[model samples]
Target: GGEGGPNAGGERERRRGGRKDESDWWTRFQNDFPWDEKTTRNVVIGFAGMASAFLYFYFRETGKEVSWKDFVNNYLARGLVDRLEVVNKQYVRVIPVHGSYLWFNIGSVETFERNLELAQQEMGLDSTHRVPVIYGSKSDGTFLMSILPTLLLVGSLLFTMRQGPMAGGRGGGRGNPFSMGESKAKIMKDNIDVRFKDVAGCEEAKLEILEFVNFLKNPRQYQDLGAKIPKGAVLSGPPGTGKTLLAKATAGEANVPFITVNGSEFQEMFVGVGPARVRDMFAMARKNAPCILFIDEIDAVGRKRGRGNFGGQSEQENTLNQLLVEMDGFNTSTNVVVLAGTNRPDILDPALMRPGRFDRQIYIGPPDIKGRASIFKVHLRPLKLDSSIDSEALARKLAALTPGFTGADIANVCNEAALIAARYLNESIIVKHFEQAIERVIGGLEKKTQVLQAVEKTTVAYHEAGHAVVGWYLEHADPLLKVSIIPRGKGLGYAQYLPKEQHLFTREQLFDRMCMMLGGRVAEQVFFGKITTGAQDDLRKVTQSAYAQVVQFGMSEVVGQVSFELPRQGEMVMEKPYSEPTAQLIDQEVRSLIDAAFQRTHQLITEKRDVVEKVGRRLLEKEVLDKADILELLGPRPYEEKSTYEEFVEGTGAMEEDTSFPEGLRNWNKDQGMEESPQEQQRKQCLNTVSHA
Candidate 1:
């Protein structure tokens, strides 16, 4: 029949149409419901109200519980009852006319009604005066409320897993937690406050780093000339020598993005996290093309591969490997310049220091007198100073005072000067405040609260006086600056010398320094007839100097002229290069040199015994003495030494009429209560006990 004719075909079509599958409930509902704004608004409102109701039921507190007897006495007998409600027939709630509501346990609806009616009748209440009763079941949402916390907890767990490092983008790993491999580099959009002018001491380093900025700002110019941009630069120096400052200045002078990360950030408790982070960091730098990436203290991860892998810490090696690959892989056109800073550059991997990787190595040593003078000028602009203070002369004098000071040290000096002035309630910092600050920075904080016995005080005085006498008379010794018996830092006495700014030292010079270092012990032995532990530090310094002269400096005649690179402090080398016999020879040389210096020192102390006694008595009377006081006691320094203040005062003819130093800079904000930069703070923190060596 279906295959026959037009009627059959039509019937088949009609049957198929009638038997066609209907839409699902949701589709039909959507099709049937009104699609206007009002309907949409009503649906949203419905959902919101449902959610609100659920929350209200979950958190709202019901009426306070009360005993049936109390409820009747408080409300029903007082004629204060408003209404009664029975919830799920398990409890009865009492509502008052002018106070809070109360609820109580009930036996049953029938029993409660009978008891209520009896109570009302016994109280002689009329029908109109009886409290009304209402009945209702508790909201079903209570069951959902009970399970809501569990549902929320499950949802949050799912969300966290979805967002954790295990599920995150790019660097995600299956067993990792949230963002363990995320780049911790700080990114700045050319918002740095440090500039080339802000840095004064590292002129060479700054000039070299500025080349990177030029390459970043004008990449095409370098490329068109067939020049390849440097892949990276390493700024190596002692602590607080402006390695970080030079990097900052490079970033500040450039218009490109600056990204900085500590080398330690690459390391993680997880094995592969360091390499993963290195990958992510490079990815970030590439994403923000024409950017500079700086890693400070890179030696933390860049140590030489084979030597210091003790305890199976191969993570640092893996990180360093990734760093090398990324640094070498940067495209010349990427305009991404990499910079690293480390005080222990000698310990870094040879591959990391290769030309194709780091490309350049800039060593920034401590500033000399001229460089220190400029650094002082930069730090001095912010301090409130006295009217008679000449900025130029002050810079020169401070430079001479701090012979080996880095830029960081000078900043510390200016800051300390201001603090000292404020401590004394002075309106402005004066020259004396600056002098005291220098002493504090060099000799450590003075501890006047430390009281010494009469014998100990006398010992300290003679000990300091012995140092002064030896240094004053020795032709090769540094000029004596000040000697004080007041306890300071961990020492019972302090003596400061104006160490001359010189690079090379002859044998006589080193021998004289050793003698000077041994002067205190010699003086103690001669006068007290017994050696005390007062010269323990001096002995250590003298011993170190003796070894350095013999082994490192090739100053020992027996050890010959060949300087051996001995193991330095903090190095983990357990084996010496030379044989045991050679080691014995080195030890003998060191002992012979020290004994000679000790004998020389003893002879000087005996010859100047009167001078030492005179100085010690004076020190006990005053507790402090300057060069002038020493000169008054002992005739004069027999040796010819250059004056520290001469260069600062010469060739400057006349003083400027302007008495005040100009305000430093608008960008150096004083409103937020910042007195110094982070570099200065870091330098201040790096200050340690003064090392005589």
Candidate 2:
């Protein structure tokens, strides 16, 4: 009994084990899902088989369709002797003995039978000799085959969802194909390399940004003082100023999460996509609290709503509305600092620029002389320079030469200088390279191959020489540094002038500047007995200055103290604030001022004919003349003037800030421009050991 019981129990256990083993195929299939290569191959093969069956059954052209009349007149009447197959009780298929089969649609089964009987009788055939009409039902196999591909496609998508690469950790990584409204903002966990000292020229804007960084680092300090952290700050400036760089510096210094998204990223063709993206972006910022959220080029979405919105709701307006709401919804204790950068603050929506949303509106204009010097020092650190080069002195010299350069322009100059040095295979960047770089940035690439005729060259030389001589002698005129007859950009020649670093000017200064602008035309008229289009830029400057004196500066007696903004060329103005007679008087005043300046320039050039003649001959012989050449020939200016390098820096708070270089650039190699620090060297050696594995 014991043996029988044990054997029976063992047999039952083996049967259960066999059942589990039989089910393992489905279990394994479920675990691997669509990721199993064999399973995927089987699925593909099955789908292909079904598609082939569908195509073959549905697209067979042998049994072509025909009208009911054609089938009756051609086949049954002629006694071509074919059998009829009625399919799905809706159509009849005729099998001809000689050729291919033809089918025709029918209205009703009873009507079809009656018509066939009548046709047989009309053809005068007996029951035995009549065409055989078979009756049968055709299934909906063709209809199912026609829709099989769509069904397979949907099934394949479901199979893929089980194990898909598209489903990233966040249920589809930013702007996910599955989630179209997801935020595409780039998130950084304080991984930025930029610091405050790396950004230069916009020192005042930097201070306001620094306050945000300080608040992020120590929120309690401000909270204890009964002060609320600013809701946001908008950095508005002309392009190429350090607006975006300051924002990055704030993020770098805060040592917290940073999320940056461009304003244009929120724009979409879908009506609600933009607003949804704005919501997702702000929610993401909240998720990483104490982070800086920077929106670059905010003017794209922040323009005043309804100004140009004609009909339907604008997606841009919706985004701006959502952004306004998001900013207002910020909790005071949440340390998400919102910073935006834009060049067009004038067109921004009033709600966006309100006191509660963007509490601070910082302006970053083109850097002054001292600000440019600081920017130069920051950009010039990586280049190989001679040991004899005094960095501070070089910075000051470059600052003076670049009168109205922004921080971006200074960086471009430094990089361009290096490129020029490399073009000549030089070991180090020199002063001449820097000078060429500045001219390239200002006047564009020199067109040395654009050869000129002798007469054209001579005319250019005299025209440029006239400017040098006039500016050299006039007490209030800007000093001339160089004159060249070599073609650069669109001009046949160019005269570089060291314009004084002064903004507020007297009537004498304005008049002298105008005469200098007209000097080239005066010199051309006097020497060549004609004028060329080479004076277009000069004439435009002269005209603008003249109008500035009359309309902008209110230096005209007829215009009185009223200053009206000049109407740009394509802009439309509905009405003038002053009467027509007053406008005529203003025009008369402008004409008189220009006429007086032209006469003064003509007289000045006439008196300095000898000096102009000598300078023009030198310019033609050398093709280029520097400040030293002019100083040696005609001597220095007689007026007491402030040196352009010293005055802009003396009392401006820019010098007190430390504009130091990062470690790699601070102690760069003397000869090879390599890093001199051991840590950098070790890092490089380690990088060299990594094969392209």
Instruction: Score candidate 2 by lDDT.
Output: 0.82
Please, what is the whole-model Cα lDDT of each candidate in the order they appear? 0.81, 0.82
* Cα-based TM-score, every candidate: 0.71, 0.76
lDDT tens string, model 2, 546-626?
988998899987779888888877878889867899789888998999999999999988998999999999999999999
Off by over 4 Å in 2: 1-57, 62-175, 568-579, 642-644, 647-693
TM-score of 1: 0.71
In the range 1-693, model 1's lDDT, one tens digit per residue, is 457876997888888776663445556777888475345445755775687686876755476988888887877899888899898888887878887888899988999999999999999999988899999877636677778667656755554444343332474432333456676778888668987778887766766776677667656657888999888999999999999888888778677889999989887776666887788788889989989999999998899897746778588888888888888787787788899999998889899999888999999999777778788888998888899999888987888888888877788989999999999899998899988999898888999988899999999899899899998889999888889999878888998888877789998999999999988999998999988998999999998888888888887778788777867778677788788998999999888888888898898899989989999999999999998998899987777776665644345453221211123221222332436656555665667433322
As for model 1, its CA RMSD to the true structure in angstroms is: 13.8
